[model samples]
Target: MPQHLTIVTHPLVSHKLTIMRKKETSTAGFRKLLREISLLLAYEVTRELPLTTETIETPIETMEAPVIEGRKLALVSILRAGNGLLDGILELIPAARVGFIGLYRDPETLQPVEYYKKLPEHMEDRYTIVVDPMLATGNSSVAAIDMLKAAGAKNIRFLCLLASPEGVARMKAAHPDVPVVTAALDRGLDDHGYIVPGLGDAGDRMFGTR
Candidate 1:
């Protein structure tokens, strides 16, 4: 079984995350780094995927080769910032079915408001992964997972570039069955509900909106 929370500590992941966190990193640079780092995170998130062996004939002999079991897994991006991580993970798992849940946080309430949702079919038969860039207050992440569960996604995992203790704890309380995979778990959320020392507004940095 996968741990409830897995922080990817690989040197390459760490180095790329450091570059991404720099305030001076250009939008192009930040976007490029996010794609690179996300691939590394995807590696860790899928580490425990079940595998089954199949007999195959090699040039020299016949042997059993392990292959991922079950139907193609689903990648559900919690949109806007989630697309950054989604693109890279798709590069690593091209055949995985894709889905999207569009949610925006209400500035006044800091609550998630769902605007759109389109998920692949047979979610219950697939291992679903919900990707988002930052897990701040965890309200949005929790809401996104709730939508997935309602759509029949029983086996699910959450992936992000950065997380906060408050956010992680909220997820644990709301959905203990799903595991979390992230590049880093930062200090905590600020009064405004942003992760402290975080790479300032992932969507803005990636898209140069700010």
Candidate 2:
């Protein structure tokens, strides 16, 4: 079993994913569906967030209400494609601290190459959620986690819209502790490293770029 993986099979998630998978889906439609699906995914990913009671006065009486505990959360988007997932998550967590990591695959070698990264200070003190729309080969995901740990982020979660079996296995082997929350786990990756039935380059679909 993939202990750390959580495939969000919620009806809404699956429904939107189906539309996204259709090759005829327009860029506008794809982007909108992604934004909606990501919000649902965010809910699943953060379902285990710790809560604390706070004293508050209601219209009727003073009471203790539950609120998230400790420092604010840190949301790390794994670059351009991650931004699609990040935008929707921000709608749900407007106050979360934001960070970005940019990585591009070397065309010939098919290896991830980091080009940019910026994270919030005191990362160890916050719960970090890394967002990306697709986890295909897992090279970028693993490398991103490596960077987070090196920067003192201990508690971390990986959130994505889609994953391949190969990607999930690779992530578990590399970072067994970090939970993986995705909308679907496809059959596997193709020879060229793309998820076999994935929606295709999420960044391109979302931004209308190749």
Candidate 3:
């Protein structure tokens, strides 16, 4: 309903997302839910993909089958929480190429700075999907996009588990060309800039840290 943003409320995804939101959920469970949700989310993101018909001989007769067009896609994960979504998406698109972009948030300024970055060759030619778990302030997500654009990626899509209004605004202003996909857009960010009522630090929750 929010332009390019697609919020999925499917029963299965909603059920797992609710569990992941619960404070009582275990680290392993959180990780698993992220994976499952990522897979489901990926399905929605690729729903409108172009398909080509292929002629194949069946056991009884020859028939035409539909297959995805183009070469393998490029999946760029904005580490480290992005890695969480990466695994699940990979399970669905095993042939997808994987890339990593590491960003660190400065506690005082609350800004994102790059730590590491690695992308595949011919990124400009491949459809790129950038993965991140939480799009709270959008600082990290914005930085990641800027980095990607600087590198040769023209076609890009941003996928996240949850997004805040502020983050969405920031992205819309910064990279309107890139569509964003998320499960839910939370209330907003807390004083510390974390998404209010958010599941806390995504990486921490996934790794069993305080």
Which numbered prediction scores highest in lDDT against the true structure?
1
Candidate 3 ranges beyond 4 A from true positions: none
List model 2 lDDT by residue over 1-210, tens digit each.
225999999999999999999989999999999999999999988888889999999999999999999989999999899999999999999999999999998777777899999999999998999999999999999999999999999889999999999999999999999999999999998888999788899999999998
- Please identify model 2 stretches exceeding 4 Å from their true place: none
Hey, what RMSD does candidate 2 come out at? 1.5
User: What lDDT score goes with residue 42 in model 1?
Assistant: 91
For model 3, what is the alpha-carbon lDDT of residue 57? Answer: 95
Collision count for each candidate, in order: 0, 0, 0
- C-alpha lDDT (0 to 100) for residue 159 of candidate 2: 97
What does candidate 3's lDDT look like per residue over 73-145, in tens digits? 8899988889999999999999999999999899999999889999988887877899998998889999998
- Model 1: per-residue lDDT, tens digit, 1-210? 678999999999999999999999999999999999989899888887889999999999999999999999899999899999999999999999999999999988999999999999999999899999999999999999999999889999999999999999999999999999998999998888999989899999999997
Candidate number that wins on lDDT, 2 or 3: 2
Q: In candidate 2, residue 202 scores what lDDT?
A: 91
- Model 3 CA lDDT for position 117: 95
Among all windows of 10 consecutive residues in model 3, the one with the lowest summed lDDT is: 1-10
For residue 56, give model 2's deviation from the true position in Å: 0.8
TM-score-wise, the better of 2 and 3 is: 2
Minimal lDDT window, size 10, model 1: 41-50
Global lDDT of each candidate:
0.94, 0.93, 0.88
